[model samples]
Target: MQTEIIVAGFGGQGVLFAGQVLAYAAMDHGLHVTWIPSYGPEMRGGTANCTVIIADEEIGAPLVKHPKAVIALNRPSLDKYEPLVTAGGLLLVNASLIDRPVAREDVQAVYVPANEIAERLGDKRLTNMVMVGALLGATGVLEMNAVQESLKAHLPAKHHRLLPANYQALEEGAQIARETLAQAA
Candidate 1:
């Protein structure tokens, strides 16, 4: 299987980190993976995005012009990448930050209130984790267990204490995505 995904948001939203986790998860599952990140000059509020490709065989390129799936964490991100998702692809939007609805009809759009959910979970930083979970749920590109394992492997030892919170955020996002899918069906 081959999956191309784009994750985008402002800096400090963990867009790059989310891509890293997804790439690591793909690697742990023995899949060929590539992750490419881009960001503006400003560190905190600048736009940041990453493209990740996971495949069962060798990957031809690291850049993704049109992705099969997208995780857009803000209105600007959604506006920028929503049109780039291929037809019949998946689009996971962070509803809490993006007030507008998706306009596409061909692709699956799963809206998760990532920021609000993360706030409820007591850590706003887990918003990206929530989006990651929704992406995994909507695309089935990676298992939750694989993502959890990836977190353990990629996160610094000093940050191990936050694993449980991240796990919770992931599960919450997955649940939201599943509910959206069910409603759509």
Candidate 2:
């Protein structure tokens, strides 16, 4: 099976980092993976996005015209990618920064109050990890343990102190998605 994902938001929202985490987890699970990040020169507050593709077999291309999933941390990102998600795919929206709902009915949608959840965990920067967790829980693309291990293995040593809050943010985000799934069932 193959899954293509796009994580998009303004710079400093960890959009690239979120894609990196997914790539690391896919590699750790012995899957073929590709990650491509795009950003403008404005850096922080500028548009930033990354594409991640994971498959059990060789991936033919790096760029995707339509992704299986999208994690949109802001309204603009949502507006851009929501329509591109494949039918029956997943769409993870960071509701704290996005005021509206997902308008598409064909894709499974998970709304996460990422910024608020990260703030409760004592680090607003972990908003990316939270969205990553929501995607994992909503789509079952990768196990949560795989992501946790990736976070541990790939996080810089200087920032290891933030691991606790980061882990918490991930769990809280997953819980939100899982609860949403349960309600749907």
Candidate 3:
């Protein structure tokens, strides 16, 4: 299996962290993975994005021109990357931040109210985890257990207390995605 994914958002939206989690999960699952991140010069509120590639075999490059999946956390990200998704690819949109709907019919678009969901979960920082959960639910690229394990492995010990909340956010996002899939079916 081979999957190329792009996650994009503002600088503080945890886009790179989300990509890192996916890479870690892929590695834990015994797959080859590559993660490349790009961001604007400004630290906060600047554009940020990351490309992740996971494959069962060797990966030749880290850059992705047309990804198989995209997680767009803001309107800018949606505008920039939505059209570049490969045909029949998956596009996960953060509905809370992006009011514009994806226009493409070639790819499946899954909308998750990431910011709102994160807020409801009592912390807005879990937005990326929500997107990741939606991605996992929609694509099944990485198992949920693998993602949870990856989260545990990557988070520093000091922040371990927040794991449950993060896990809840992930599950909530997955539930939203599952509901969307059910409705589509």
Whole-structure CA lDDT of model 3: 0.91
Per-prediction TM-score to the true structure, in the order listed: 0.95, 0.94, 0.95
Give residue 151's error in model 2 in angstroms: 1.2
Error of 2 at 1 (Å): 0.9
lDDT of 2: 0.89
lDDT (Cα, tens digit) per residue for candidate 1, span 42-153: 3355889999999999999888778999999889999988888999989999999899999999999999999999999999999999999998777678999999998999
- Put down candidate 3 lDDT per residue, 1-185, tens digits, no spaces: 78999999888899999999999999988999999987346345488899999998999878878999999999989999988999999899999989988899988889999999999989999999999999988877899999999999989999999999899988988888888888988
At residue 118, give the lDDT of candidate 1. 94
Clashing pairs in 3: none
Q: For each candidate in turn, give its C-alpha RMSD to the true structure in angstroms.
A: 1.8, 1.9, 1.8
